[model samples]
Target: MSTPDTVTVDGPGLRDDPSRPGPVDVPALLAHSRETVGPALRAAVARLDVSSREQAEYHLGWVEADGSPGRGGGKAVRPALALLSAAAAGAPAETGLAGAVAVELVHNFSLVHDDLMDGDRERRHRPTVWARWGAASAILCGDGLLTLATEVLLEDRSPHAAAAARLVAVTTRELIRGQAEDVAFERRADVGVDECLTMAAGKTGSLLATSAAIGAVLAGAPTAAVRGLSDYGMAVGMAFQLVDDLLGIWGDPAVTGKPVLSDLRSRKKSLPVTFAVQRGGAAGRELAAWLAHTGEQTDAELRAAADLVERGGGREWAGAEARRRMVAAERALAGAGLAAGPHAELLALGHHLIDREF
Candidate 1:
C-alpha cells in the first residue's frame, strides 16, 4: 500500500493542558466547550417538559438510552473553532462561547438527521440516535437542537447578533442543499469533480465558514479579516471532506468505528470514486458497472473496485488537493492578520485536518 503523507502533530488528550501554550491546547479547548456549551444545551432542554428534556439529553449523548447520563458525547470541535477564532481575533474567548454552543448544537442536529437519512447505526462509537430512539424521535430531537441553536444565536446581545443570524440561515440552507446533492449522487452515475466539490463545500464547508465568520464578527474584526477567516474556514472544510473521503476508503474499520469500504458498499459518490470514474478508462467502466449492480458483491469485488480507484490516481489526486487546500487555508489565516500565536495554531489546525488518522 502506498503510504499517505503526514500533515501535523496530533493534539493532546481530551482535557485541557495548562502547561502548553499557543494553539496546541486542544484538550483545553475541548474541556472549555464541554463545560460551557454542555450546560447551555442542558438548560435549553430544561425549558421543555420532562419527556422532551429526556429526548434532547439522549440525543446530545449526555444521557443514556434510559435518559441517564452517558459517556460518549462529541468532541465539540466546531464550537472550539468559533471560540478560538474569536480569541485569536482579539475578543475574550468566553464572549464567543455561546456562538460556539450554537454551532455545535446545529452540527449535532445535522449529524442526528444525517444518520437517519443514511441509515447509519453508529456514531461516536455508539448506537446512533435514530438507531436507539427510532427515526421519529430522532427527527424531533434534531429539530429541537436546531431550534435551540437559533435561540442561542439570538440570545447573544452583541452587535453581530444579526450577522450571526444571517450566517446560521445561510449555513442551514447550504447544508440542506448539500445533503440533497449527496443523496441524488448515489443514484446517478454522471457526477463530476466540480459537482462533488460544490456539494462538499455546501454540505461541509458552509458551517465551518460560518463558525469562523461568527468569531470574527463577534470580535469586531474588520470586513477583510472576516472574509479572510471565511476563506480559511472554507479551505479547511474542503480539506476536512477530502480527508474524510480518504478515510472512508482506506481507513481501518476498527478505529473508524464503521465497516471498511462502507462508502463503496453503499456506492457513495465520494471524491476519489467520482474522480476515478471521470479519469479512469476501462477500469473505471468496470467499477461503475459494479456500483450499478443491484446485487451485493463479494469482498473480492469490492477490493477490486478500491484497487481501481487507487490505481487510477484518485486517492493521490484527492490527497494532493487536500494539501493544496491546507496551504490555501494557511494563506487565508495569515491574511486575517491574527496574532502570530493564534495564527500558528490555526495553521497547525489546517494541517491537522489533512493529517488526522481517525
Candidate 2:
C-alpha cells in the first residue's frame, strides 16, 4: 500500500507550513467527517453479532481489541471528497452525509479483505482485524460493512437513495477486480506498465470516482457535473496511487507506519517494479534475477532492488506519471463547475495529495 506524508489543509494552500497554517487542517477535517458520518456508521454496524460488531468497531478505530477507545482510522479521504463534492455543487454538506458514510464503509471493507489476502497483520500501528480476531471474524466484519453501506444509503429515502446504493455496488465490483489484478500481478514476472496503470485505476481509482460522483448524484447536480467529478476523482485517484507506489519503495518507515522497502520485501509488483522489469535494461535484468531467486529478501537485497528500480528509470517515470496525473486531475476538477470555495479546497487537496512526506 502507498502511504504518503501527513497532509494538512491550510486554506487554499495544501502545503504544510508551521508559520501560516492554511485551511487544510487535516485533523479538523477528520473531526468534521467523524461528526457527520459517525452516527450512521455506528447504527449500521450496531445490529451485527457481538464478535463481528466488535471487530468492525475495532477496525473503524472506535474501539480497541478490549473495547477501549483507539486511534485507528484512516485519513477519511473518500468521505471528505464526497462531502466536498456536495459543497462544490452548492448543496449543504449535510446533503452528502449518506454518500460519505457509505463510501467510507466500503473503503474499510476493502481494507479488511485486502489485509487478509495479503496476510498483513498491522495497519495504522495496530494489529489488523484478522490478526487480532481471526480471519473469519475479519471476513464477516468486512461483509457487514459492505451490507451496511447499502443499508445506510437505502435508509436515506431520497430520490437518489436507490441510485446511490447501485453506484456503490458497481464501484465495489470494480474495486474487487482491481484487487484481483494486483494479486495476479504478484505471481507474474512479466507485468507491464500499461497493465500496472490499469490495475491502479481499478484498485484505487474506481471507488474515489464513485466518491466524487455520488455527491453530485445525491445533490441532484446535473449529469455533466457528475461525469466531470467522476473523471476528476479518477485522475486524483491515479495520482494518489502513483505517489503511494513511490512511497512503497522509498517512503520513510516512521511516517508510513510500515517497514522500508515493504513492497519489495513482499514481492509485490508495484508501478516502479513493473516499470523497471519492462525496461529490459541491465538494472532490470538484475532486479528480475533478485526477484526470481527470492525466498525471503534480506534488507540488503531489498535495498539493491530499490536501487535497480531507480537505475532502470522506474522511479523517474513514476514521479513524472504522478505529476501528469495531478495536472489531469486539476483539469477534470476545473470542468466540474464547482463553486469557488469548494473548488479552492478540492484544488488544494489535489496539491496536498501529491506533495507530502508521509
Candidate 3:
C-alpha cells in the first residue's frame, strides 16, 4: 500500500487529523470499501459454475490454487471510487454496492484476458489462470465475470438500475475498442500521441468514468454532478495510465510486479515512448531504429532504450502530463455538488494514483 504525497493516516478510523490539512485516511477508506463490497462480490462469484468459480476464486486472491486462504485481490480502486461517488451524491456507500461489484468484475475480466493476450504467466506473484489451468478455463472465467458485471447492475431494484446497466454495456464496448487499439499499436512504429490518448481514454478512462458515475446515477444525482464526476474520473484515469507507463520503464520491479524496463523490452509504444519517437532527436532516432528490430532484445539493449526515452524527453513529458491531468481533475470537481469529505477523498485518491511509484 502506497500513500499519496498529499494525504495522511494519523487520525482515528476514516477521519482526518484536524491539526494537518489533507484528505481522509485513505487506507481506511479503501479498507472500508473492500469490506463493504466483499460479501456481494463473493455471492456473485459463488453463483458461477464450478470451473469458473475456481478460477475466479484463485484470481481474486480469495483462495489459493490449493483452495487455502490467500490474498492477491487488487487495491479495490474501482470499488472505492464507486462507493465515494455514491456518497458524493448524498447516499450511503452501500447504495453503490452494486456498481462497486460490477466495476470490479469488469476490471478482473479485463485482467484475466490481458494476462492471456500478453502471454504473461504470472500476476501478484502467482501463476496466471491460463498458466495454472489452461487458456480455455481462463477465457471462460473472463466471460463469466463480464456477464456477471451486467447481471449485478440489472438485478438491482433501483429505478436508475436500467440506465446504469446501459452505461456499463457502453463502457465495455469502449474498453474493448481501446484494447483493440492497444494491440494494433504494439505492432506499428508510427503511434501518435493523440491516438494514444484516445486509446487510453477508452482502455482505462471509460471504465473508471463509469465507476465514478454509475454510483451517482444509481443514487439519482443530477446530470451535471454525474458529468463532473465522470470527467474527474477520466482525468484521473489518464494520469494513472501515464504514471503506469513511467513505472513500466523506470519503476522498481518488486513494486511494479513486472521486470525492469518491461515496456522497453516489449517495445511498447507507450505515451512516453510515443513522445520520444515523435521528438525526432538523435536519441529518438536511435530508439526508433532499435524498435524497428523485430528480434529479441537483451537486458543491456532494454536499458539503453530506457536511456534513449529519457534523453528524448519522454520521461519528463510523461511526469509533467500526469501532474497536468491531476490539475484538470481538481478543476472538474469544483462544481460537482459533492459532499465535502467525499470530494476531498476523491481528489486525494486521484493524486495517490499518480504520486506513487507503484
Q: What is the C-alpha RMSD of each candidate to the true structure, in Å?
A: 3.7, 4.1, 3.0
In candidate 1 the C-alpha lDDT for residue 236 amounts to 89
Better of 1 and 3 by lDDT: 3
What is the TM-score of candidate 3? 0.93
> Relative to the unseen true structure, what is the C-alpha lDDT of residue 283 in candidate 2, on a scale of 0 to 100?
93
Each prediction's Cα lDDT score?
Answer: 0.76, 0.81, 0.86
Per residue, candidate 1 scores C-alpha lDDT tens digits across 9-55 of: 23321224423442354445466667866777677767655555676
Question: Please, what is the TM-score per model?
Answer: 0.90, 0.91, 0.93
Q: For candidate 3, give the lDDT.
A: 0.86
Over 4 Å off, model 1: 1-23
Q: Which residue segments of model 2 deviate by more than 4 Å? A: 1-26
Top-TM-score candidate index: 3
Candidate 2 per-residue C-alpha lDDT over 179-273 given as tens digits, one digit per residue, 9 for 90 to 100: 99989887888888999899999899999998877877888888878888888889888988888888998999987777899889877788888
Native-to-model Cα distance after best TM-score fit, residue 157 in candidate 3, in Å:
1.8
Candidate 2 lowest-lDDT run of ten: 9-18
